[model samples]
Structures are given as structure tokens and as C-alpha cells.
Target: MPEKPPAIESFKESTKSPESELSPEVLEKVMNKVQDINEAGVAYSFVSGGPYSAGSIFEQDNLQKTKLVRILKEGLLGTPEKFYLEGVPPTKEQWAKEAQVSLRKGGRSNVYFNVTGMAHEEETPNTQSGETWISKSAGSSKKNALAFIFDLSKFTYDDDTNKMSRKYYETYYKRSTRKFTTAYGFNLSHRVPPRFFNGILLKLQDNYQYDQLAAEIGILSEQVYKEKGNLLLPIYDVYGNLYWPKKMSYEEVKKFVEERDKNKE
Candidate 1:
């Protein structure tokens, strides 16, 4: 594996330290488990602190978020207790609740995969924003994320799930007391176009298959350019950034792929 680039090393250092401020034993276990997941080339992000969010982290001040937040605060949370549970499973009722969240958030439908993992999310009476951690589930969907909330005092999270709902591993620094929300970690439904998928790939050193998936990123990018224009190009860099003037067409990309493949000869 290549040495950590200076940029990524700095990023890792900042996020890993203060976030690891949890108790020594818990922190050790958390990092070790995350490392194991990293080594396994699992598609996941180790997130800490920020707004509670779900789905694409694009767009802001969305009116569609009220349902998930309301349900989380006032709906079906079970009683909290000493030391929390070692592990808990989701009930069918909770799954149905997720579907409702989907509709409220402008999604066409809801789908659930069996999942397992821990997460935390919270909203406070006095504060403008909240935070969460939606773990990647080891189950069918791969990365089941967590949601969390912290008032001036208490901190708590929701059970992780794979179904496409919002508030997955979200966190926020400052939002409006009057309106809006922020997302801390990753947006699960967020995906890069095929062409740039390879370009923005993560966890490559851990597995060769990662290369296979990303090797065609250029092709995917071309496809997106043809059909969707530059709508999602910024996903590779940052939100609202386009590396190229506009997306390229499929035929143009196909020719580029053929030319690149021939160059290996």
C-alpha cells in the first residue's frame, strides 16, 4: 500500500483524535473494529459529530425533513436505561416507520435490508443543531449508519439500518434556531457517476476488486454526462463542483476507453 498522502494523514489525525476521546477501552475497540472494516475493504466511513441526516446531503432548508425528526423525538423510542443494550434488533413496526420517513422526504418508496450495528443522534431544546453516527451494518446493505442527538447534556443514537432513510450518521455545527438542518457524515444514497466512481474511489489499497469497480469510473462519468448532464459531477470533488465544462457523451467516453485500453498494448 502507498504511504498515506500528507493531505489524508492530516485529515485522519484531526478526526481520529478528539473523536477517539471516548473512554480508552471503548475507543480502542471502536477504532480496532473500524480498522478491521477498513482492512476488509468494506464501503464505510468512520464518522463523528455533526447534524443528523439521511439520503443525499445535497440541497438545504428542505421542508421534507420534519417527519423523521418528529418521529424520532416523539414517536417510538423505547425507554432508555443503564449502560444501554449490548445489541438490539429492529421490530417490524420500526421498519414501517422508516417507510413513512421515506415518503415524507420525497422518496418514491422504501426498502429494508436486515441490518446490525450501533448509532447515536440527538436534538436539544436550546441548541440550533444536532449530531449522529449511523454505522455501516454488517448485514445485506453493507453500511448501516447511526443517528445521534445531544442537548446541552445527554447524548443518544438510534439503531442502525440499511434502508434508505435520512439522518444516517449526520452531525451539525450551527444551523438556524428558526429553520434548517445539517449533515455530518455520509449520505448513503449518494453515489458518484460511473466514470468518476473510479476516480473518487476509497479503500483501494485493501482490495484489488476496488480497482475493478473504479476502473470503469470514467465510463460511468461519461454516461452521466450524456443523460444527466453535469448534475452530479460535483459528487467527485465537492458539492456543486464540476471538473469538466459539461458531461461527455457515451460514445465519446466509449472511444476514450478503447483508446486507453489500446495504450496498454
Candidate 2:
């Protein structure tokens, strides 16, 4: 455990008195939770107000996330009254209609479902760009919808899990407008690759050599960046981005082929 860093203290202060401020009680809970993390020796960093995000926070360990989830669920959502519940749950037909409307308006994706175990997709409104058809079951309960709200940014692989996670979490049902406002939260997870390197790697995709070298290279790359305070044998585009080369390095390409052959070993 270490003393609270100056940056972390500043973050706590800013959250306490921000333009869109949290309540004193909530702020205290947040500060305490952050202190607990620091005391537990968890490594973390925070980024605020990205275009697609409110805040982007990263931690070294998954345990930190599990602990934070419990704290937020109990602290911010302490009372049953803070949430909305349906006594007589909506009918399946009503749920489907709501889901279809939501999918149509989502813009970047289509909706898919299985009928007699055969998959079918509802077409996207705009097809100029690639759209993925994400299948989800209709929400039957508030708790289910809350769980969906919690996992909105998570990418689940299992069909059942993905379906459950993608279900809409309806917030306000405007009678006059005949519309539902859905609520969701975002978390930036560890699974995403680093910001700069992915495009180059994507071009060499399906090459086993590239996969092995990339897996082994990340640590080595970080060490070089830290010790020398410079990039390794730099190549950059007009925008000074690593992605500018527009081709995999010859050394990496050769190693990629070599590694592919050895994978048969």
C-alpha cells in the first residue's frame, strides 16, 4: 500500500465539486472507495470526458473491478425506490415491439434471432457501412434490465449471455411521445488492444507468426519505451502515427511466417 498520490487526491477533489456535482455523501463514498483501492496496492489510471465516454478508468487486476461493482451497486443504488419496477411485467409481444423499435433506431446494428433454431436478421436501415446483427431476448423484469444496464459495454461471447446482456434497460416511458428512453453505462475493459498498434496487426491477421510475435512483443515494446524514452526504429506517417507505414515491417513479416511454421511443432 502507498500514500494517496497527488493526482488521485486532485481527482477526488474535482469529482467532489465538478459542474455536474455528486452529492456530498456520494462523493465521500467515492473517495473512500478510491482510498481502499490505493491501500490494496491496485494499480490504476483514470481519463475523463472522452467523446464516446464520460471517464475511462483502467486497473491492473480484475479483482479491483469486482470490488468496485459491489461498492457502486450498494452505495449509489442503496434503496429500492431509486429504481423502477414493473408489477405486472410487459407481455412478450409488447417486449418484442419495443425491442424492434430500439434496434431500428440504434443506427449501426441490425437485430437477429433464431426461429426453429435457424438464425434470421432484421436488416439495417443504412447498409453503406458494415453492421453487426446482435440478437437479444426481450426484458421481462426490472432486475434483468438493470443487469443489462450494468453490462452495456461488455462484449460477451456466449449466445445466452450476449442475448441477456443486450436486452434494453428502459428508463422513461413518455406517454405523449410514445417513446422509451433506455439507460446504459460504459466501462473500458482490458481486452481492447493498445490504441496505436491494432491497425497494423489487423492487416497481418490470420498469420500465426504475427499472433505469436505480437503476444510476446508487447512487454518488450513497453520496456524499450520506458528505458530509452523513445520509439524503437521509428517509422511514422504524415500524422506521426505508427499506423502510417501501411504495411507490416519486413522483419516482423518474416518472423510471422517463421513462427507460423514452428507452430506446427
Candidate 3:
């Protein structure tokens, strides 16, 4: 039997009204920070499944200076003036403490930009899911209250398919529940292009590569929200059920998948 949809209480409606608007000047600064990190590319390690293991986990440090943390602090936390004027910027020690807090709470308390790295298992053949969301609470007046949900994936050099592995997709989809849903939120899946990971599997640091990656993300962002284009990706509900792109139910999706698999057999 198929699983039931999650209760409404599990996934609360996102906060209405922008927390704070970003001026043109501040918006530019924030984009620049995002571009910088995209260009730098994050450092990560493959655990459990090795390079080709669809179930492998990608692990990275969430330190104050790391790409993830830095992006959150500088980009979403507001400009230097805002931080300085309000109070001293959070120190490395402070960020470390907040990271723990954020992890425990499942999201940041004050800011709406949440970065989550979820690893399901400890043993071999594990899968890791990394998600970044700029919720309505981030303060954008855009029509879609929720800015976007970024699903991060790594691309390997030897993998010529240029597609996410089926196993990984299933794992990610199954694991996303309860805290994952948002009303009218756009879902954007990003696979770091192979160029950034060629030769060196650990870190990507070429200025040109970073620019390209950042541009790709920017283009995708525009395509989905700016132009209001449709990518035909399914939106998931709190129960990890398909909530959009027809059927509007997880059982329908399951039946469809089963039928397709049967046809192939």
C-alpha cells in the first residue's frame, strides 16, 4: 500500500511579507557573493559509495570560512554596514555555535536562508542530500513568496551520462519530507558541471570555472522565476509526495513509475 500524505501541521506555511527588502546596491553585492562562491566551487569528499556509487555520500566542512557558511553570512545576513551597525559580525566561534543550533532546529532562527546537509546512513553505500532554500522570510517581494529550493549534486569527470543517477534520485526523493515543503516554491536542481571537477576531485578553484558555474546558476534562476518558465519538475509535499505537474498525488506517481518499469521489462 502507498504511504499517506503528511499532516498539514508538519509543514507550516512560510512567513508572509518580506523580512527586509534588498536595495539595488545590496542586491548587487549579494549576487556578487553568490557568484564568487559559485566560481570558487565547494570542496567535498565522497564517502561510502566511492566515485561511481549512486548511493555515495558527499561530505564537506561547514566551518565559518567554508563556502556554504561564508555564502550564508555575507549574502543572506546582509551587508557589512548592516552587520557592523547592528552589532559585531558573528565570529568563527559564533558561527560554529550557530551552525549547531541551526542543525538542531532544522533551519536558522532569524534568517530564512537555510542550508541543510542530510546524510541518511553511516555505513557503506550511503547517500547524502544537500539543499539550500531562500524562503519568503528572506524578504523578496517577488510574486513567488518562496524564492527557490536548490538541490545540489556533484558531477564527476568519468561519468559521461550527464544525468543524475536513478538510485541517488530515489534516495533524495524518499528522504525529503516534513520540513521540505513550501507553497508555490520553485525547485531548482543543480549538478556541478564536470569542468569544475576534472582531474582534481576534491576542490574546484579556477576563476573561469567559478564564473561559468555561477552564470549557469544565474541563468537557471532567471529561466524558472524571472521569465516564469516551466521546467516540468515535480514539486513534493510534506510527505515526499508529488504535488504538481499533473496527478497531484504520490500514489499516481508511484503507479506511473511502476507502469513505465513494467513496460521496459
Each prediction's RMSD over C-alphas, in Å, is 20.4, 21.8, 19.4
* Better-scoring candidate (lDDT), 1 or 3: 3
Candidate number of the best lDDT: 3
Model 2 bad stretches (over 4 Å): 1-49, 52-246, 249-264
**Ten contiguous residues minimizing lDDT sum, candidate 1:** 234-243
Report clash pairs, candidate 3: 39-210
Question: By summed lDDT, which 10 consecutive residues of candidate 3 come out lowest?
Answer: 123-132
Residues 93-150, candidate 2, lDDT per residue (tens digit)?
Answer: 4434544554455421112111111112222111122111111112111111111111
Better of 2 and 3 by TM-score: 3
The full ranking of all candidates by lDDT, starting with the best, is: 3, 1, 2
lDDT of 1 by residue, 41-100 (tens): 122231111232223111264221332222222322321221013222233355345446
For all candidates, the clash counts are 39, 0, 1
lDDT of 1 at 141: 21
Better of 1 and 2 by TM-score: 1
**lDDT of candidate 2?**
0.22
